[model samples]
Target chain A: MLPYGLVTIEDRVARLLTELPPNPQFPTQGATLFVDLARRQVRQAYTPRRIIETFLAGRGANMFYLYRLLDESLDPIDPSVPLIFGSGVLTGIVPSAARGNATSWSPESGVLMDSNAGDYFPSFLKMNGIDHLVIYGRADAWTVLWLGDGQVEFRDATPYLGLDNIDMRDRIATDLGGTWTRDLAMANITRAGENQVLTSAIMAGPKACYARGGPGAKMGSLKMKAIVVQGQTHDFETAQPYKQYNKEIATKLLNTSVVKNALRTMGTPFLYRPSRVLGAMGTKNNQETTWTDRLDAENITPYRPGMAGCFRCPVNCRPLNQLNDDQADRYGRGDGPEYVTLGKFGPNVGIDQVEPVIRLNNICNDLGLDTASTGSAIAWAMELYQRGIVSKSDTGGLELTWGDAELVERLLFAMSHREGFGNVLADSTRAIERGHYPTEARKYCMAVKGLMQSDPHDARILKAFALGLAVSTRGMDHLRNRVTLEINARINDDPGFKAKLYGGPVSAQPNNYETKERAVRVCENIYGVGDAVGMCRFTTKLFNSPSLPGLEEFSSQIANVTGLEFDADVLDRIGLNIMGVERLINHRLGVRRSDDTLPDRWFDEEITVGAYKTEKIDRQEFDAMLSRFYAISGLSDEGVPAEAWRQELELVLSGPA
Target chain B: MSITVRLPTTLQTSGQDSLTITEPVENIAELVRVLRRQLPGFPAQWDDSMLNFSVNDEVVLHRAEERVLASGDVVEIILALSGGTPVPRSAC
Candidate 1:
């Protein structure tokens, strides 16, 4: 039974839902959906006049966009319990919108975790008249939740249970709605999630995924199949501010020569060759960082069908990779095999072939598993096998050898089904746990705070990236700020810009440990702001160092979209607040200075590649750098936020659950 | 002292990691001209607009001919491996 006496705000188009305080302690605004089997309701009660103060702009985007700011009120959102989803103020409207967080308490790390994915659902959701959906309690049986024209419906989903993503998509479309004719999207769960696999992702679409923590399993536990969002791209005249704002990015992406050609032509797979040259890829689970010969555009091109884009995005960086007979025999074709997939499965796992790598990628999508974690885990297992720590007996009678694609496929299948050895690889944190390994295997695991490392860019080569990987709030993610100033130090900026932005040298060489702390601090702040505002880092030149969307333009985008006053300074403060608040959340979750360090491999082992040879995070220097960053972040010596800073961000206060 | 000029993956000569100029070259222009006569397809994969030269590790933004190179200097034709070719940062 749904909670009775639920204050309803059925504006229909712009619904604001709130959970009734079981204890009347925590006052939550930004739409938190609470669902039960019997009925679905939107509760926008407890409208304190002071709640308007909480409204940064229109319930901080009608209690949608700036929802993550409501994190303090909505802490301990058990990912094992409620399957929650929320959007940003300008999610569906902006052309560069690639983010909207799926906030939940991680079953893997037992911390607050949010997984971000791009396109489709976020945009059309607005037109259909829904901000966000938060599911509470369990459904009686297998169910499908559909949202259309401001109405929520639940149908029997017993028939579609245990189906793969591709087949599931077609079946879901037929059952829930019609074809992909409308701009409809859903967060689809899989068998991996149903079985409580920690690494399972809620499939965002066929290609992309809201992957990180086990959101799928959370949905599966609820006996829910998919949250079908039926919405359309609204007309231009209805919201002139939105139209003008969308045009700002759409026009730039269409006309600008800055980001054209490369992404469109080769997509992200083009990075393979250069990364090989620099010897910067994490090859064979970081035992080696470079590949002598690996798949690049030349080999991967033969499989490319065309370009793939997110909802209304023109700078589509995904290649629709098709499979041949032998390749198709193992697994059918899919949209990506993105750079992350390529890196994780290709060089990282020791497979140089593009076809099998692509197939492995498809299998990840189909099974609704995170390719980054799954592939990295497989690579880690392969290394263990080589060391004789893992044998055929433990591997379920298959050899865990490097560059073995067939074995990779078999292992992924097992992982999805949570069968045999796959169960061990499912939870990264468990593997990191002492004595969880067959032998002394915890040291070999390349993860930060239980979450798997992203992008596979060897941190040994890029120092700032290493810092970010060490200290990222969520986990080891590159999107926190794709630190490329080190890569393009000379080509990008001046002493003025550098000093103004990061208070560092203009030609801040990638090798120099100096000035990196400042650089990383600035990058994280901006990226946090981008994440908060639901801005896509790729399309907009946010942290790509001196690129597009300068301060004035950034603020104008916010003001234009929401009719709120924002600028570079305000954005900086917002980012700082988010980071500070995130610190408090982690503080509550037991993450401290001790957890804010890199893997042993990064500190002990030198990068055995030319140009970056004899490079590793010097422990003494890194320790001091972390201290400097803490000071800059207004945190105490122990990486805890100052009491004053927490109060300023309203994090010191709390509400009841 | 003679120097070797190296190229990235896109511009490197087949089966060669670098091109060594034992003959004396005065500047970048002289090096480019000599390389054109010396190597096949020297300018085929290059565009004047796209090529940003790095003498040693420092970026050479303008007047490549004026930026003289003596012996033991490594000249690298800078181009992004993926896509970001070095566009000039406006003279400050």
Candidate 2:
């Protein structure tokens, strides 16, 4: 049980009603499709923002992300309750407006969480006229929710139980009628989800995936295989009225932004060498920071097929890796070997071969496993083996050695198939806690809450990211606040822009823990705007680069698209409101000061690498930063939001039903 | 005088990570001549490429070849496509 586990649903509702403003109509309007599997009933509820505020209270991405958290599903560990898929209000209305959220109680974190993906899935859902799809109750057997233009059908999914995500997609497509249509979008989990692996990731469409949190395991428990939505014969709705103007401006901005275009050209593999060069690559489960430059971007470019982007996104950062080699003959090709996978599977696990890296990436995609968590799991085990904490006997006679890409490949399959040693590894953080590793080995496990760390940029190097991961509602996530990634030369060189960006140039260093909390706070608010607005952070000017839009620029863009007359201040308030809901959800899930912390390794030890050879977080300084963070968030010392926060935001929480 | 130029993956076709141009060059054409001479026909690869040059973090997006370099100045020729780190999958 959680420390705040006793915080009941009723108590939460009462607190919500106490804190929220009087019921006001939501800024946007849409129909919520509610599906009750047990009752065999599907209902549509036109819940305006006022009613949503009474119960959940949010605008775009925040509402979908936080609503499930506000109720009994707040800490859903194999919950028999509800799971929701929410599209942002402006989803399908702009380029790169392709992210939809799988908002539910995560089996990984045991709290209200979201696993988000960018693709045409959200677009198709919007075209189908549904903003949110809420699934609850239990089915007697395996089922698939065939959600089309105007109809919902519950079909049996028992036949596709053991197939991998790729195969399942093909089978489902054939079942729905053979030819692939541009109109359909599908999300499914493979055997990993079926076995309820803690790191199960949901694969959406063919390439895009919500690759964090084992919410797929929740679907596994429900005996649900996939949720496929097809648009009714019409093309995806365009952002009309201002469609041409919006596209022209957006295209101009995207075209002019060298960063955005570079991503589309090089894909994410470009960061492999640079990350190591910068000493930010998490090597050997973060026991080391840098590795040889041989495995960098140049090595991986040989296998590129072209660039791949999300449905509406003009920026294609996912590199399409096409391999015709013998192993590639087996694993074939897919989108990635992204920096996270390349970082973890490459340096984090001590492997460097680009071919194996690409293969490992495809393996995870097919199995519907989260590469970040899977790589971390293997790396942790390898660390244990390196220290004699775990033996070959423990790993079923397989040597858990570093740089053994083949072994890593075997371990991935083992976990996916629940094979001997894989079963032990698949148990997640508990595998270590349950004495799988020597208790002393816990310090090296680099996890926040229960989920494994996304290991490209180590927290010791990036303090803002460290704090962001520690407090993010969806466990340790980088995308939750993309601003921390902007400790680049651009910010370092320009003091005027730096002053406007962070506090000033003096506080802009990655190692500057004093003002890092300020950056994190700023990033959290603006990223919330992106999530709520359905825009990707990479394109945003606030977090990644100053060349992009800030609050005022974004407000104008929203106005241009939705015809909503929101300014920077209004948008900032909306962002803060979204963040408030997220914090409260985490709070209700039993998050407190103790949980809002980092592993001892980060605070106690200095990074042993280039540039940061003498760097480590000052524990006292970090604590003060935390205090400042809470203060900036308008929360108490305990991280509880002040009632004044609710009053100012006009949040009126509804009591009971 | 040695001026260091960091070669991105696209420009590093010869597997050289970085090139140090000791010969003096005044303009982009001179720099292109040096590159063509050094790597032999590599400058032709620049056609249809969205490449930009940066001198000590200052992006000289236009006429970078024509841009003058100071002695011991660090220059980065980045593929305007994948400019270091923008958005990685699970961007940190």
Candidate 3:
């Protein structure tokens, strides 16, 4: 293993060895393990050019590295490609919203699932003396890695199988002092991971989770149970020159209006009203305008829940609430009931009661299910009930009525256990569509490219969001790119002024589509930069925080931390490099543009209410948007990576073609 | 005469203790003019510019040129656009 730093890895390991009782669970082959330093790969000497290049290239670079380590012949479904957990140079050190990213050829969209779960991996890995950990090859038995001080101890955790996420978290917390914050440690999978359900997620925090692409199931299939890394409190260190830079950035972030207003006050639940007004909040399986009168009925407004935040994030968006009734005993009081969960579980299912929604949120959390997908599935069932397709008999005498909290809670239980009709629902809308409801299944699935869609919002209303969803590697996810802010700002402020800036006919009032192609390109770059730096998108988009402006600054931070110098362009190259490599992997696995498609209902039926009332997204327009997106992204017309882009990124162009 | 304005849950904590704010009024426009004096920094206006008004739970369509308000009427001003966080429209 490489030397740790002012404190060498060997010395740190020896210190840890002295503290813990001798246990055989520690890996015997310590020589094979090594820390791959990422500081040199992320720093830069120049500023302006490096900043742009880093934004353009960082995401691809990470993807390329991950692809090289995986089997090229296997598809995303083959369970061979390794899930690479990465942290950017800014992680652990920079106090803004730096986070960790998970990159893998997804089983959900058969593309790259580049997602940020929370701050645990970023901060923990930094303290453990590393920036990224490429976890490859399946273990023969269920195992867990305890990354602490300087050494990584691999323990056989087979006995902990079948435990829920909450139980796993509780057990881990108890085992390693109850004071260990959830932001510092994460339990990837519990019972749901063991089941290997495609829709399963790796639950984090009290309510935060990496929900898309079944990473939890992937862990189960590999027989890898969980990995917990705890950072030492005294690990914060900074070299000369760059120490002042870090302090200045933190000061600017605290004073920014974006941090004080947009995120701090509303949290993520703020998306509900705008989405509902725009007719994007999917209701009744995207078949109706509104779900219930619950937005007003439940009094679900934003309120502070004391001091709750991720590893160094100032914008504490997670709202904590106390339940003083009988349900509080069974379900512990903690964070969340975010907009997506509340919208899908409450209003979308025809219920407006906040209490039941909270209960359902807790149930999904303990069971380790993706609330977005679970709620979407329930909404689909509700639609099925309304259409007379599913009745009391299908639901085992449970009335699938709208606004029935009791039935909603029961369904959540059934879905998690895979009991009764829950077996069919557990397989996800994609699988369900392919099985029983082939002809009409796509209508209710509300997915794009096989991954289930997030909270309801019509892409057509906001062109940037629509295009982002269309071209997103992992189906209809929004975090991949968020250009909706620009669109929203324009509409909310001055339509005429925005129209001029966007460059189109002022009288025509071109919808989000007019500038979608360009907006999506920029958004992709922004997302790439955020992922590479280990920063949350909300920090940039919502809080308006500026990251390292150029490579010199990035390198300065890295040089101070890891004593390494890297070109800024190298960081930008990382994002594209990762995306190109993942696309190549997907192509080998047989994922194509034809596979990237929205639900049929979006194209066929007209929305009857809200901003997009009486409008339906034209398939032709959507196709045009995708074509433009792919072309700009350096992908071929067929949505495959072009040979030039792949060659430039140093990824092997050889694949299905 | 006077009209009372009810604050939504989000704005209840803004030192507006009572459920309703009473102000003298003539018409929707005049009532808003009166409210500006009553509640400073209230982020709303009463121009015939697509303003939606409700009196005692019933929607009132007021023309910019002709609409008028009477005493003892409970008037609620609804912003055309909504969502994000939970800040009041005036605060936004």
Candidate 4:
């Protein structure tokens, strides 16, 4: 059944060593916990040699390995498509590395998807000695899987089925007789996830979520209500260099970086004013690029009475909003109203008020829905209604009008329950549009590979940002390769800094396409490393701050903490290897060079109302940029991985052709 | 006769929400010079990397000197924070 010289799965397993290569001893490395609900079996296994490169690296690498191991034998919606949670190698050991990854076959994106989230869940997971937890097969009933103190328990979760994320957390606390914030941490879904809504997310804590790619839908499909981790903090012996570097990073983050000042005070809403001023704000489903000042940072600051941060993070960037009685009725209070949430819910939908936007954000979060997808989906429908493609009759006599926050809130509840018209929107924009006006609605869908566009930046003006969104592994996302530094207006003239950062003489002009491939490639590598190490990109060079921790610092930290001798170059290679695996995975799923493209709207529609009017992506220039990107990424013009890349990554093609 | 210049909280002078430029200004550079003179703690020289200017809600991406300002124009002066991209989650 296998081709000549092809390595089988069995062969790869046989070659795996039980222990890591002898290195400086550290407690970061741990066993993979495999839970099989179908057989009611739980087992612990060491990282296999085949995936050790990614396994040792963690997060993004872990996500890549999961996608690589996606069972071609099963359908995308199959419950056997294991939902895997991976802790970063440096997670819990270093500051800003307080994140974890949740990867599964996306029922929405129709591809393998990984969503990263902050909070102490990942740290708790690592504390409980789990590097990666893989849940396999569907449970016979709603169940909660509890792991802590080297014990695994499967408890009945039927009573908690219809609860929102906040209520579920409370119930879990009451049932377990432990405070969720103090001793226990959890990942839970809400009614949206329970109903297998394609846009659902998994709430990681009260404040954060793994909010993309429908990992929540996968969990719901598996009949998993929650996974709780009870952890005891373990102190690791660290070298002097590690301690010194850690202190230096904290000092720079707290006292040095000017960017952190606004972030600390206003959280992500600080970017809102700048986004509007830059003409990047996507208002009214991206038909316009500006909105009312009611959603401005200064205006929104009143509701944000406090701020919070992930474990060990210095910059407390999460805004804790004070909810009114009406807004708190269902969703309850959680941290939010971030830039994206405000952008998507406010300007993108033509609603300008800050409080109402925060209300929508709360409802979406409580329902375990991806705020990006939720807002984008509703925006698309509103646009459809504007175009007269969708009627009030189709919307169950409710007018899908712009700025109708009340109607949007009602639809969100209906979507969670899959009621009437809301059932149609529960899927992606592409699917919803296809089911209605397939031919006419296709262009207005604003989706790339079934995932709705998340970033509220109007892509017509920013060429590299547009390209990044087009080629993202998880379609239409900003987090993957967004060169956030492009927002620095001063960079426009700083060719030297651009040259040094991108490793080429790239233009810093947002609209320029020449030499942009280099910048994109560098960003991809940096983000790759950031995700792999379980560190937030905001604290890394990927964010606008140039002096933030980069590959070299990550390398030093990893060496000092784990004794793994990964130099900066090796870390970059790991990033590239992850890219290579993603390419292969997408290739297997029928993605080609043709699919690596922006929507026609981006190429055709110009920003009509700005000083930078007539700003649109040049198709020919974008194609050339794509070619350069492919060449640099070791891919053919067709976007397929080259033999050299495969050999370099030690990847052998042995599956069905 | 005057341009209403809005300032972010970080760059506000004497906790004022906005400042009025009484001096005649040709462009953002001239406006910045007036602000440096009028407002205490304002940098002596215009740092293009540190501050961003928008005339009538339109971003003057580069060469702020070229963006001609008119009387009664709303020239928003804000700290040059990072660009308009959000982090992975809605929150950081």
List interface RMSDs for the candidates, in order: 6.6, 9.9, 10.5, 7.5
lDDT of each: 0.64, 0.66, 0.56, 0.75
What's the CA error at residue A87 for candidate 3, in Å?
Answer: 1.7
Against the native complex, each candidate's DockQ, computed on alpha carbons, is: 0.16, 0.09, 0.09, 0.28
* Per-model B-chain TM-score: 0.74, 0.71, 0.54, 0.76
Q: Which ten residues in a row have the lowest lDDT in candidate 3 chain A?
A: A38-47
Supply candidate 2's per-residue lDDT for A594: 72
Please give the RMSD to the true structure for each candidate, in Å: 6.3, 6.3, 9.1, 4.6
Q: What's the C-alpha lDDT at position B14 in model 3?
A: 66
lDDT of 3 by residue, A111-186 (tens): 5666567645556665565544545445666777667665566667776777787778777777766355543576
Candidate 1: share of reference interface contacts reproduced? 0.05
State which candidate, 2 or 4, has the greater DockQ. Answer: 4
Best-performing candidate as measured by TM-score: 4
**What TM-scores does chain A show, candidate by candidate in order?**
0.88, 0.90, 0.81, 0.94
Q: For model 4, name the residue pairs that clash.
A: A487-B83
Off by over 4 Å in 4: A1-26, A48-56, A237-241, A256-259, A325-332, A430-437, A650-657, B1-4, B22-50, B65-73, B81-92
- Candidate 2 lDDT at A329 equals 65
TM for candidate 3 is: 0.77
| Candidate 2 local lDDT, A479-561, one digit each (tens) | 77645434454343334545666544436465667666777777777777766656666666554345554566556656664
Higher-ranked by TM-score: 1 or 3: 1
Rank the candidate models, highest TM-score first. Answer: 4, 2, 1, 3
Tell me how large the interface RMSD of candidate 4 is.
7.5
Docking class of 3: incorrect
